[model samples]
Target: MEGDSKVVESKPHLGIPEAVFVEDVAKYLKEQGSCTCEEALKKLEENYQKYKLMEVNLLQKKQRLKQQIPDLKSSLDIVKHMKSIEGTDTTMTTNFFLSGALHAKAKIPPTKEVCLWLGANVMLSYSIEEALGVLNKNYTTAISHLDSVNKDLEYLRDQFTTTEVMLARLYNWNVKQRRAAKATTNGSD
Candidate 1:
């Protein structure tokens, strides 16, 4: 039924296996000695699924990091701008977006401290210098994380290609073996 849902057992996340060469599939089958082609195919299919799932997760993470890095840079820029204007008697004026297509004009009075939202319904006041330091640190960390994610995505793509090639080679080997057996049986008859 399309509406039916099954409860699945939760297991700890499994690490992805190292990619195997296409020729290695034959060695693996020979080592098994009695593993049917069907069995080997099933195992390879499962491994492929694991790699696909991990790749999907990494892509989602990359998308989030791409969006977050820009916002972080923007926040850092605003804080830096404020610091540059410090010690001057000029009030800061800017347009704040209230919602889609609506803007509100705001004038920020000169002050020694600025309030920063720290997420989860909490905000804290900090000196302009302190705010700059915090924003810069956050920006750097996000960039580093994005770089790591990109590297992982590259590795995953390689694994995907390797698994597909292995599957094809194993299937071809199985078909040739079946044909050879059939020919021998017919000749004996």
Candidate 2:
């Protein structure tokens, strides 16, 4: 037996078969795909938060502008009334409130002209109509700016919705791939 040559069969080392390869490839793809999808979702969530914060800020800004408009309109009405009263009386006496409070009051002489604040601590003497014109212009500008903010908010909302849909689709695809890979492995085994 030692001198004679013995015929021995050697095993073939085929790296992997077709079925196993399919299952492994599917599993690897699912894992990698899901990881990428999760990262994307996280980034999308960050963007969503930023967008929501920006939306809130925009709303607040618009609200401030709207509030200013109403107050300005009230001031304009008061100025119109004052202009009418100024021409009628040569010397007018009115109660002045101390500390700008209604409770504390004192008598004071009112003149014909009134000083109006333009902007940034800038003041100028103007007739009633001129003051009214300035206030009206400011009101219109605020209104237009608010409209622009509304449009921007709408665009941001659309983008947020799109990202949400994309995230959902990616999640669904990941789940389906995982299930398919599991089924392939189980069937092969």
Candidate 3:
């Protein structure tokens, strides 16, 4: 029996030299004696090559996504700036028209046509002022609402961070308890 075992051990085998530290796996495969070592090595090499290719692909995707983040942020900033400028221009134009009409109304003599023009200008200015006041109030309200939303989001983010840390601690404790229980069960067996 000892001589036969020696003969078996002397034969070259798949996964033996490469995995010398893994005694249990080596013993199991040696018992099977199914495939040559060269075949297993080739398969492992192919798998490693495929894994490397997948890693490269994932790294490329990560780099591309990182590049996009700054560009998207800049675009968002540009859009916000443009909207602010547009709002200011609109307000200036409205103010200019109102001031010009007021100046003309004051200087012009009150002939029938001039009185009619003055009346129209005054009515239009009043309507514009009313509309502007409503819009200003609405803009203030919108800003307050956006501030509330940002505060809520910040609170939620902090809560989520705390919960994540708590979850990690719980998971570690659970793993320790499970391992202790398994060890106790195995000792009894």
Candidate 4:
């Protein structure tokens, strides 16, 4: 009911049939006898139980999914570690060959170029590691936020559904009461 007005306004055409059906049901209930209230209450209780079961099943599934997040993080960490080591090996091989070539040419070949290459490799490695760290941090943060949001949504869904069931039960009871009163008055006449 929180956003009922907005929903009604948003789907004016689509809601027409549903509104008509509701009106028809109301009219039928008005003609029912004394047993209508009890029938309506029973129907509401049954619907509440069904919703309760559905909520429980969905929450269980959510919990299982939440539990998998840590495992996923661990697997990602392992992959990052393996990749870093592979990068270091590749850098070392390249440096070894480059440095050897520069030193082989005596007469004191300028080492600036070799130094630049080595410096670049170091910077690249550092950047890669830093990026991985940031990625891991972000992954954990996102999972944490998702878990919290899912929990809050589950609570709200259950609350709203329960309230709806109760309201429906009350409305049905009132309609039934009206029908019973009319029936008694007509019978007495």
Candidate whose TM-score is highest = 1
User: What's the TM-score of every candidate structure?
Assistant: 0.84, 0.61, 0.34, 0.41
Pick the lDDT winner: 1
In terms of lDDT, the poorest run of 10 residues in model 2 is 11-20
lDDT of 2 by residue, 1-28 (tens): 5434322212111111111112243354
lDDT (0 to 1) per candidate: 0.81, 0.63, 0.42, 0.52
List the RMSD of every prediction in angstroms: 9.0, 21.7, 24.6, 15.2
lDDT of 2: 0.63
Tens-digit lDDT track of model 3 for 35-107: 4334444544554454345445545544654554454444344333334454243321211135645632222
Q: Candidate 1, residues 133-188: lDDT per residue as tens digits?
A: 88888889989888888877877788889889988888988898889999999999
Model 3, stretches more than 4 Å misplaced? Answer: 1-126
Q: Give me candidate 4's TM-score against the actual structure.
A: 0.41
Ranking of all predicted structures according to lDDT, beginning with the best and ending with the worst: 1, 2, 4, 3
Sort the candidates on TM-score, descending order.
1, 2, 4, 3
Off by over 4 Å in 2: 1-35, 90-112, 117-125
